[model samples]
Target: MANIEQRGENSYRFTVYLPKDAKGRYPKERMTYTVEGKYTPKQLQEHLDHEYLKFKAEVLSGNYVRPEAMTFSTFIKEWDKKYASKLAKTTHGNHVRKLDLHILPEIGHMEMSQINEFILMKLLDGLQRKDGQDGELSFHSKRDVYRTLKSIFKYAVKWKVLSQNPMDGVEKPKAKDTEEEYQDLQVYDEDEIAQLMEIIQNELPHWRAMFTLALAAGMRRGELLGLQWNDIDFDNNQITIHTTIVLTKGGPHIKRTKTRSSKRTVTLPLSMMEELRTYQKHHKNTREDSGERWIETEYDWVFCQFNGEHMYPSSPSNRWAKMLQKHNFRYIRLHDLRHTSASLLIAQGIHAKIISERLGHSDISVTMNTYGHAFKSADRAAAEKMESIFLKK
Candidate 1:
């Protein structure tokens, strides 16, 4: 039985009575509300009645929704639908991948109400252990997973879906600063770079121009593929990065650059300028050969497939991986090309602010943070030079 008692002129208290057991233990399952003064007694009564009926229906149907049942998988789908439009495609894709690969498989079906600190700690412990695929998960990956879970729970609390986040008190695993290992970025020294360029020009003529552009221009893989003839200024020897090719639900599409700062202009080096001029001559001839078959969009991308179709993001990365494997080069990620460019610039004593602008980073902080170790090395060299000057005096 449920009853509503008027506490004041603008207040009403509602209570639901649970059946008592033989031991006279009654469950205190009740909800209270204080109606606004604007509502008449009849209107207030109607609203209260509706709420009571809804609660009764839920009780009868045995469909009580508990917070514990809100698994990561279920909540993420809801979150995506509600917030996907506001998120960048890459970010949304990453969120979905993290949930699927880390959160869902571990605790997808568990009741959200049942998840407590103890359960989460155990789960983290399991993740740290090396039993699963790819041996044990790295500290970096584990930290990311933990952070993702924490964010989800925080959102759940804000939405009133849960009273508190279970991850609130959980401590994250300590991660070593791996910056030292990459202090001196593993890039081809001048001799090695010369050898690589020679091989590409002589042996792999087809991919020679693209490899040269990547090393010289420092354009990101996706950004390189997104390059169009229209974006290049032959007279000025500069290239504007306004868009990038990314994989979306329907397939790959030319999306806006990752950030506003990423859409920038970088002056092409003399060597790269010459290569582009030659490549452009060949590209135009090829387009003319295709004639009517050419699908001309307003943006004339510089790099495309042999058939003049837009290149997929994965193709170049795959090629790079294969090249590295064949040459027995250290397995550096494709993005390392961008790092190599920044490293070379820093090594030449270029200012970080200039590098930041060239790299199209949103701020100098991004440049410093990403290549802080390189900067530290430069600082050490500066100190040594100063000591040598003073000692000579």
Candidate 2:
């Protein structure tokens, strides 16, 4: 299966001839593998013989694949350059961390053709969030790893490196108790939202405008922080979301919407638009007052700092939490404001599809899944209306 040849006094080369490929195509240029190393005369023959046997075993087992392509690490360079570049910066950054920190270090050296279900499962099972937690990994972290692996294996199949995706054999990861996660979903009910609407009016002009628009438009945190003045259409009372700001260790980063659907236009209530106009006047005065000191960002951010810099991504959440605490209000995470907006629409019997479009959800199923409680309430009201009509007949 192999032979050893002397290249120098202490260096020798071992070449192992690989077997025929799938279609029985028996011989190609890159199918053979050669390893050259300097070895002592006493150990040279035995070392080359062992390496030849090992190489032949890999070829027989269908693990070596096309030797030129070689390891999973080698395939990733191609995937990163060609495919991963298309992914959103936040998503691509996340994938890079999962691959480099976890997956690649473990199996990057293994031939792409050699990866199997057992190997993948073991890697996922061993995953743990290195942050403040016990050894048990969070379901979310493990799920990300599973998603990353599945995408890689799927591409491996498409790129003809592997015959099938090994992830097909692996069960999808799930939370141990999904109900516990659902129970943690805190949203302000209609009454609480109403009270906040009134309270924010008296609090401050800047915060009032921000909080009102958040509840009205149901924009994500980053989307709100990244909102630019040009994105607004005063004539139509609408705003487009095509860019987002994500805080990074280096600083804030402007990224495109994660998916096509995430780039959307949301129609605001007329009253909210009116309030925004008023805020714009106030903002202009503030900017002029800071004339010499005002900083400018790439976009004319609608929710800029007093000095006209882009608002920090986490600023709203932290400030919201403090405001709730100070006022002794029932607390919910800032994200739950989005859920509160959806709930208000559901209460008014807005169609789920319309709500999904307004919220810029990638799929209607995501809207249904996250706000099933609101859907249930809407459904109950529909049933009662049907009952009243039938009873009257």
Candidate 3:
């Protein structure tokens, strides 16, 4: 038997009766569910009715189990080994970390079948509240946690553990203003770049060539570190980027570029190429002096330690930060150099398509979306120039 009772605004209780006991006498206790949301009265009744029908069908089919029968904590641990194992190492690590740190502490004890849309909404809203370990998380972080839960529920559906995914009704959070603020703070200007370059030339002679290549080609930090002497074409003045250095928990690992577009051939400026050649000569002399002490890999990396070992992926960023600090320059992360390259190109009337290719973005839309503000500024400047040329007295 199913009966729906209103329990204030946007809330209702669904009372479901169980089968008779051994002596054909009904049990005193029944299941009552309190559902809450933004639903109107009619919508709330409709939802309760639907859930009642589904529960009756499951019971009639001999498949109904009480909500308290299965816990989420038990299922998620099993899900990790079987499903999470199929994911990439880094991705799998992220999933486990989130599950352990943020998710499990909140909902792990609840049964999967008992978790409804209302519960999911409350959990997400709680995450947005400024009461967690690091205060209120960003929309993106909350969204990621939501996504992980969604994926877990999807798995539950696939395994026939639940008939519906509660997250299907939840709205994913939108981009907040902090994203724009962070992106704008992640780049440098022409004057700052010139000053940094001069300091790099004077003080950090060994890393000067790599830093120059970073600003000039917009190559990623990993790509720059993975470069080998053979990847460079001195005659053609182009460098092929097919590999990258990735740092994981274990150690530094050599892997392919982030995406297909990331594995590109970028033409080097003549002066930059000459500087690289000069650096190559100096590196060769140093290697010869080191003799048997040089630990050479198969590729003979262009950038490495004094003993010719692979450089850690984080070293470049750390070194760049230290150099700026020592010279009393404005602090910008090493990756900001890539943004600087894009900003400089956008300011010089270069087409977005060409800049996208130079930056090795998988899609031009990514490049456009990232640099839209810069493009807007450039567009305004272009319009002013046209007015000066044709409308001036």
- lDDT (tens digit, per residue) of candidate 3 on 238-351: 999998887655568788886788889999889999999999999899899998898775768888888898798899998888988888988887888999899999999999
**Prediction RMSDs, each to the true structure:** 5.9, 11.1, 10.7
Angstrom error at residue 37, model 2: 36
How would you encode candidate 2's per-residue C-alpha lDDT over 281-300 as one tens digit per residue? 99888888998788795568
The models' CA-based lDDT, in order, is 0.73, 0.79, 0.79
TM-score: the better of candidates 1 and 3: 1
Query: Using alpha carbons, what is the TM-score of model 3?
Result: 0.73
Predicted structure with the largest TM-score when compared to the true one: 1
Quote model 2's TM-score. 0.69
TM-score each candidate. Answer: 0.78, 0.69, 0.73
The alpha-carbon deviation from the true structure for residue 144 of candidate 3, after best TM-score superposition, in angstroms, is 4.6
All candidates in order of TM-score, best leading: 1, 3, 2
Clashes of each: 8, 0, 0
Q: After superposition, how far is residue 311 of candidate 2 from its true place, in Å?
A: 1.9
Spell out the clash pairs found in candidate 1. 67-113, 68-111, 68-112, 68-113, 69-111, 69-112, 228-301, 229-300
Q: How well does candidate 2 score on lDDT at residue 92?
A: 78
